[model samples]
Target: MDFFNILILAIVQGAAELLPVSSSAHVIVAEKLMGLDPTSPEMTMLLVMLHTGTMFAVIVYFWQAWRDTYFSSGHAFRSNARLIVVATAATGVVGLLLLKLIKHLVAGNDPGFEIEHLFANAKLMAAALAAAGVLIIASSRLPERANGALNLRTAAWVGAVQGLCLPFRGFSRSGATISTALALGSSRRRAEEFSFALAVVLTPAVIVKEAFRLYQSHALTVAKNGTSLLQLVGPSLVGMLLSFVAGLLALRWLSRWLEQGRWHFFGAYCLVAAVVVLLVG
Candidate 1:
C-alpha cells in the first residue's frame, strides 16, 4: 500500500473501530475501492495492526473510567473478572460452534475452504450490517437500568451474542454486545465498559492469528513486492499510531453520544451504512 492509502485506511479503521459500526467492513470496502486485495497478507497484517492501534486507544481512553468502575475495590474486581470469564467463555463456545457450522454448511463440499473467503462477500456484509443496526436500535429504545453491573446470566447472554459476530465480518462486535447488554437491562455506561473490556481481552488473540496467517502466506507477497513482512512492520507501526489517534477521537464521540442518549443515532447510521455498502459493492 502507498502512504496515502495507508493513511486513509488508518483513519477509517480508527474512527469506526470503537463505535457500534463495523470497522472491518469499512476497511475492506475502502480497500476494494482503492483496488487493493483485502485478503492479501500485507493487507491482513495491516488490518490487525490497525486493530492494535484502536485497542490501545481503548485502554488510553478508558483507563480512568475502568479504574473507577472496575478496579474500585477487590470485591468489585473479582466480581467483574468472574463476569468477564463467563462472558468470554460463552463467546468462545458460541463463536466456535457458529464458525464450525458455517464452514460445514457453507463450504463442506469444498475441502479447501478458509473462513477468510467470506470476509469480502458484499451481500453477507450488508445483511450483517442490517442485523447489527436493528439490534442497536431495538436496544436503544429500551429504558436503561441504572447502576447495573454484569451478572452471570447477563454476561453469558452478552458473550453468546458476541460469539455470533465472530463468524460474520460485518457484524459489529461492540455494537452487538453493547446492544445485548442494554436489551438485557444494563445501563449504557456499564454496557460500554464491559464491551470494551471484552475487546481488550480478545485483541491479543486476533493479533496472533493475523500474524500467523501473514507468516503462512508470506511467499507470494514476498515475490511480488520483494519485501519481507518484517520490512512492512515499520510502516504498519506508523499506521498503528495514526489509527490510535483516530480511535481516541472516535471513542470521545461515541461516549458523548451514548451518554447523551443518542445511541440510536448510531443505529440509524448503521442502517444507512448497510445500504451504502450494498450499493457501493
Candidate 2:
C-alpha cells in the first residue's frame, strides 16, 4: 500500500475501532474503494497492524479503570474479578460455538472456510449493520440507571452479545455489547467500562489469531512492485501512533456523550452509513 492508503486505513481503523462503529466493515469498505484487494496476504497483515494500533489506544484509555477494578485488592475487586472471568468465559464459549456452527453450516458445504468469499454478499453485511444500528439506538433511548458496579447478570449478557458480534463483521462489537448491557439494566458508565475491559481481553486473541494465520501462509510477502513488510515499517509505525492518539480522543468524547444518553446519534450516523455503503460499496 502507498503512504496515502496506509494513512487512510490507519485513521479509519483508529476512529471506527473505538466508536460504536464496526472497524472491520469500514476498513473493508475503504480497501474496496481504494481498489485494494482485501484477500491479499499483505493486506491482511496491514489490517492486523491497524487493529494493534487501536488496541493500544483501548489499553491506554482504560488503564486507570482496569487498575482500580481488576488490579486493586479488596472485596469489591475480588467480586469484580470473578464476574469478569465468568463473563469472559461465557463470551469465549458462545463465540467459539457460533463460529463452529457457522463453519459447519456456511463453510462445511464448501472446501474453503474463506471469509473473503462471503465479502461479496453486501446484503448480509447491510443487515448486520442495520441490526447493530438499531440496537445502539435502542440502548441510547433507554434511560440511564443510577450508578452501580458490575453485576453477574449484566456481565453475562454483555459477554453473550459480544460473542454474537465475533463473526458478524458489520455488527459493531462495542455497540452490541454496550447496548446489551444497557438494555439489561446496567448503568451507562458501568456498561462502557465493562465493554472496554472485555475488549482488552478479547483483542489480543484476535491479533494473535490473525498473526498466526499470516505467518502460516507467509502472507506478508509483497510482489516486486508491491509494498514489502520492511518498506511498510515507517508508515505503519506512523499510522499506529496516529491511531493511538485518535483512539484516546474518541474514547474521551464518547464516554462523555454516553453519560448523557446521546448515543443514538451514532445509530443515526450508522443508518446513513449503511445507505452509503450499499450505494457506493
lDDT of each: 0.89, 0.80
Tens-digit lDDT track for model 1 on 132-236? 999999988998889766789999999999899987878999999999999988989999989999999998888899888888778777877777878768778
Q: Pick the candidate with the highest TM-score.
A: 1
What TM-score would every model get versus the actual structure?
0.96, 0.91
Residue-wise C-alpha lDDT for candidate 2, range 1-281, written one tens digit per residue: 78789888888888889898888788888888999987666676776677788889988888887787677878767887777788898899898888778878887856668555666666777777888999999888877778755688878878888888888878889889888988888888788888988888888898898777766545335433555556645666777777787788889888987886689988877787777668765
TM-score of 1: 0.96
State the lDDT at 112 in candidate 1.
85
Separately for all candidates shown, the number of backbone clashes (residues 3 or more apart, or on different chains) is: 0, 0
TM-score for candidate 2, residues paired by index: 0.91
Clashing pairs in 1: none
